[model samples]
Target: MRDLRIGIIGVGVMGADHAERVVRRISGARLVAVSDPDLPRATTLAESLGSSSAPAAGTGDGDAIRVIEDPLALIGNAEVDAVIIASPGFAHAEQLMACLEHGKPVLCEKPLTMDTESSLRVVEAEHKLGRQLIQVGFMRRFDPEYAALKQLLDSGELGRTLLLHNVHRNKTVPESFRSEMIVRDSLVHEVDVARWLFDDEIARITVRAPKPTGLVADGVLDPQLAVFEMASGAIADVEVFVNFQVGYEVRCEAVAEKGSATIGLGVDVLTRRAGHWGGAVPDDYRARFGTAYDIEVQRWVDATARGEIDGPTAWDGYAAAAVCTAGVQSLQEGRPVEVEMARRSEVLG
Candidate 1:
């Protein structure tokens, strides 16, 4: 396969990690350029490319990573074959729209956008283009355990799934992690996973935040429960605790009429001692789902090279945003919030 010159927006933790992964870890792609509001951060990452970088067109160094201050310009760079949008969630809709206009394949970090209306705009625009150019970064869809569960449910080996019990625990969240983020940032993964596995949309959501964890300075809700009522009459309840201060963990159990399946049982190195028996838990998402993210990105690069869009689509991103919006609303309204979405076009369907 030919190497695809890639430009990534945003040089924050996730963006930087992705940039390094593409240039070093993943195949068939090179980090030619990067953009971030913080030009220094972008420059820092570009400098750190350390001989592995491929310079953007018109630049002096063919083996240098160029610093593109304006992310939009990077999207249209003649040297860039594809774009990766890892900017803030709120910046996603505009960046995605730009990708659509340029007819460039994009792998956008999820939520798609922080709201439904903006996400819908991207979806509608992609539909207007008559091609799927955007693939959302919902890495769990690529996780082996999650994929196995999805396959079991799809194969009828589990009969009909009746319930899904999900748990998302983070050892700690940064100071920026706020209350509503419990739904927007954290539970958003489960929101997408539930939809992917069940092949159904979430109809309603009820969030319960009993009390603040008080672990961090932020008064954000923690150790909360979100109940999702799926269109297929299946129920998925997710427990999202961001300040567990223990370890990062994600688990799911699916109950079916015939049988049941469960996953996320600490797939790590186990230890045995005179008085203890336990396994190492991932300290963060990068540790737990690192392989899944790699697979997702590799598949995206290979498929895009073949003129195809793979993995989660714009519709899925829009749907997850809609559900997440409702989840936040439920948190505020103190009641069940109904998920509202626009009609799905035939192309997207």
Candidate 2:
């Protein structure tokens, strides 16, 4: 099996996890290079991946992983057959465009970009290239349960989905977090789910806040609700609570004509003890979607090896960002805002 050399930008939690997954768990790919503004963090991740500090050409005693100073350079590295943009949202658009320029397959984490216009630029770039080279890392679509639900809906046995109820909760947020992140960061997953499940675009968004739990960091909103009107005439609502302090939970229930289906129960392990029934609650996103992440990466690697993108497209990312942008506008303006999405390319269409 020829290895697909993968370079990852941003050695944060998600980036590090991806590197480790590529090195240890996933097949058909190898972590060849990593970059971060914090050089030490990148070096530390490279070392832990059983790779020594060596250039792509310089082989140490083990599989040496190169440390690139600039993410743009990482994209152009001769050894990097693919790029994974785990960097911040502000950096995503440029790096994605770089991938298109370098003609490398890229797996970009969400937001694609901070706003609709930036995401559209990537869409335009991919369309101009006339190939599918970018796959947005919307991991839930790979989850077994989520996949089952989607298959159920596609089977048409449940009839047309009329409503989708989603819940996303976290134990807490960092001090740097802001109220708008409730829509930008957390509920954005639901935005993608709405698109993936309903196979339509978001037409409208309405945001509501019902007081903060105060358990979260100061100046950050604890909980928020955003309702969506899908272009397919289906509706979806997401409840995002980041300071519930219990555990991380992501769930969705779709109500259709014949019946309903639900996923994301905190059922890692269900037990009966102390005269009570109990189940384990995931501590964070990693615990909640661990399996999904593995499957997502594996599928991406396999598809990239086949010269194809197997997950969410650049268009999916752009539409999700458009919906999230409208969600933020609704949050600020205290009213429903229509999503501003324009398909500028037939490839994306």
Candidate 3:
């Protein structure tokens, strides 16, 4: 099998994990180089991947990965056949454009960008490139349970899809995290999942803010509800609370004419003592979705090696961004905001 040379543009938590998977877990792809603003961190990660310090002619050496300050430089490097954009959301547009310009396939993290207009620009660029070169990192779509649920829905076992309900809760996020609202940070996943499950664009969105739970009074944002109307007339409700004390839990259910199917939360049992049954809850996003992330990266690597864009496309990213933008509006207005989706171009397909 020909190895696909890939380079990651960020060395942060998620970026580092992608590097690890590329080197250790994935067989179709090899970590050719890694670049971050912090050269020291990049070099350390490269060394840990069993690469050398001296950069090779085409690909970097075994002990060292090419550490560069400019992410665009990584995209243009001869060694990097594909690029993974795990940098900050704000930097995604520029990095993605560079990759597409170089005709390298790219797997970018979710939201695509902070706003819809920027996301549209990405879509436009991919359209101009005349091929599908961008895959947005919506990992939940690759989750086993979620995939099962989608199959069930598609099989018509649940009868007419009338309503969908989801709960996304985080133990807590920092106070400074409010820079991005619940729509961008917490509810964005729900937005993506709901759309993917229903295979429809959200037509309307409304946010209902309930009273804050006592457990999170330190300006902690908890329990935000978003109601969505799908283009197919399906109604979906999502409750996102970042300060839910129980554990990092994600729950979803689809209500249909005959019956409903739901996803289980947490592990079966963590401990049985004192006449009590307990199950461990994940501490953060990374833990809860660790398996999903692994599957996502592997799929991306495999698909890229096959010269195929297998995951979420640029259209999905733009649609999510549009819905999220409307979600922010609905939260501000405290009313249902109608979302208008642009026509999908052939390039996006």
Candidate 4:
């Protein structure tokens, strides 16, 4: 069988990483094309891989990869068998619709469409097709530690998970990263994790901001706390600090009826120096979750090759968007907000 011909949209940080992974690391796929609004960036990425990358199975031309100026054109390219969309969140809905129309499989980076309505539309469109073709890029589900924790929970070794505590800290963010983005971009992951780990929908959420860190602008909330009440009566709390001034750190501890376990402590390589003991901290998510991303794309490619999606679905994206929409409302109003969502059967059936 021919190797899966993959095209990537948005050659920014995440996109470029995935493109390189397809060329160098992943098996059963070849980077056939790339597209970005910035033509030069896309061209550079394609060229950078051209020499080191193997040409796709049927492309007899010496051209290893094509740089398409338009994302839709890239998606429609006959040489492209599957697509990886790392475009900005706002572009997801339209691009996803195009993928559905083309019958192409896509692995899309999250926010999934910036809002609940668009996400639901994508979900409905895919549902109408009677095929699962879209995979939301929530890479944590593929992480080794997270996978182990989930397995432990599923095995009944941890009994019933009662509470989950998450700590997400970033070194800093750009000035344009506003208050609500912390909830949308950073806390959204926790929302998905909570749903995944507990297997329950969030019933209500309340966001509370602590004193603003001097490092951020006046209106931006540097550190915030979000509490989630799940449908199963489990509680999950998140502490999100986007300008923590420390290395990137994401830690999660699950409290169960029998025991508790934590991950992401970065203690795998602890060191002892002249009366001091510590280990390296990841500079950013790219460093911390690099392995997870690799596993995620590889699995997606393998599944797409088999005409299936083996990851988070469009409904998962819509659910996360719904919770985050409520999270933003809670942040703004300083009150508990109920998560409004359509019943799964109502949407899927």
**In terms of lDDT, which candidate is strongest?**
4
- Decoy 1 TM-score against native: 0.94
Error of 4 at 32 (Å): 0.9
Error of 4 at 50 (Å): 1.0
lDDT of the candidates, in the order given: 0.87, 0.86, 0.82, 0.90
* Candidate 4 accuracy as TM-score: 0.97
Tell me the tens digit of each residue's lDDT in model 4 across 4-38.
89999899988998888888778888889999999
What's the CA RMSD for each of the models? Answer: 2.9, 3.0, 3.4, 2.0
Output the better candidate (1/4) by lDDT: 4
Residue-wise lDDT of candidate 2 within 1-349, one digit each (tens)? 6678899999899998888777777777778899999999999878867554432322222587889999999999898999888998889988998999999999999879999889888898898887899999899999889999999999999998999999999887776778887788788899999999998888999998887785766666668988999888889999999887888888999999999999987666889989999888878998778899999988998998888989999989988888888888898888999888885455455
Tell me how many residue pairs clash in candidate 3.
Answer: 8
- Model 4: per-residue Cα lDDT at residue 137: 93
- Which runs of model 3 end up more than 4 angstroms from their true locations? 51-63, 213-221, 345-349
Give all TM-scores, in the order shown: 0.94, 0.94, 0.91, 0.97
Task: Mark the regions of model 4 whose C-alpha exceeds 4 Å error after superposition.
Answer: 53-63
